[model samples]
Target: MTSAPITAADAAVTSDTITMPLEDVIDPDEFTPRLLALLSNALVYRESHELRRQFKLGTNEWRVISALSMRPGMSATEVCEFLGMNKAVVSRSVTRLQLRALIVLSDGPRGSRPLYLTRAGAEMHDRMLPVSLRGQEIITEGLGATEVAALNEVLRGMLARIRSDAALQGAPGSPSQYPID
Candidate 1:
């Protein structure tokens, strides 16, 4: 089973570039990968805007907070590895969060410090949780529980496949990071 190719004019989002005409290659509406990227981008854009307005938080900072919320005691290196984010960016966010008194670090051997959320950080995370959940609810409004579960199953499988592919191809450069699982 294959989807028909859609032209630039037909899909309006087949290609990112505006100067060149997008060929009837892949219809983002029908293509799973393109659809996934578009949806992820939409979610990130929304998060970036809302977080900045609501919490004065950048996407990077929120990402770090999110990782820590799920897995406490993660070092910056561990966060970078898990989130596939740039070390420098994560470092800066960590510093900012620390400055805000939202996060604290535990001393470790050889200057390796594990990150932990402060009382205020946890409170902020609690507040932010509803926002994220609401965004998810909005996106899944028409879908049944079973359908959403199936979609997650598919996405998880895709993530696993991509990780395996990346392992085979070798790690990407520091400038490019893998998707956070």
Candidate 2:
């Protein structure tokens, strides 16, 4: 990475332009994979904050509602796995939703209790559905149907690669098999 030319006009600049922003120095649309992931997470944070403010639901709570709405009945561990969220956060959210009368617990195989959304929870999901749908539309505004499908396929591949790495890390002797450079 090279620094911009320094001159009298640039002397007052204190920003680390040399290495601070790779996207800004290049075409803004061309982003590194790291930056793309960061931006995707940041967008989720922003959306979650807005939804929390508007609907009186925390991000995790909203996610629980959303997940149950889709999956009908899922354990906290299952929700955590599906959402790639921390177990504690999902557990707390499950408790909160239950206390709020938004969800109900039901017995499952092996004495497990899976969560299911109540009528109120379904109503909330109905109301918040537009927010996510519109957000998706905005995110893929300029893309054709084919392009959107391709993007989804590529994202799935990327997620699979990361999931494989996570699975490997959990296996015994895996780290020793592939030492970090």
Candidate 3:
């Protein structure tokens, strides 16, 4: 493995970049992964904040809702795989949705059962769809369609590459085993 050398602009004393919280000691610009992680955190925070206020659900729970809406008969284990989230997190979200009558579980394998959104759950998902779509638009507000497509392509490739990392193979809820591209 090789590490990319940091550019001078990343840590030059004369540069006027905002490297706050880490100062010149570390630059977020020096790390593409850090920048991407920050962007994801920002987007999830914004959406989750609004979701909690509007529907009493956080982004993780919302992800579960979205997953079930897209593929109604998925088991909790399948949902974990689909979302690349922990089993415990998915299980908690499943329990919360069930308690609220938003979804119901049907028989399947002894431990992993299929789950489906009830009529109310479907309604909630339909109502929440706009929030998710709006978040996407906001993030790409200035980008043209072509640029947006390019950005999406890059993101997909990056995700596929990261998911294919040998260290992640067979990890809990690992998507690494799947053919991403």
Residue 25 local lDDT, model 3: 56
Local distance difference test, per candidate? Answer: 0.85, 0.77, 0.83
Q: What ranges in model 1 sit over 4 Å off?
A: 1-24, 173-180
Best model per lDDT: 1
What tens digits encode model 2's per-residue C-alpha lDDT throughout 1-105?
998888877666567545355553555466667677676787678768777888877767887899898898788877776776777898898888888899999
Candidate 2's TM-score:
0.72
lDDT score, candidate 1, position 20:
65
Please list the residue runs of candidate 3 whose C-alpha ends up more than 4 Å from where it truly belongs after superposition: 1-26, 109-111, 167-173, 176-181
Per-candidate TM vs. native?
0.78, 0.72, 0.78
- Give one digit per residue, the lDDT tens place, for model 3 in 1-181: 9988999766677567655565445565888889878988988889999899999988888899999988989998778788877789998998888998999999877776889999999999998888788889987999999999999899888777767664456544356333343
lDDT of 3 at 42: 87
Cα RMSD for predicted model 1 = 10.0
Ranking by TM-score: 1, 3, 2
lDDT of 1 at 86: 83
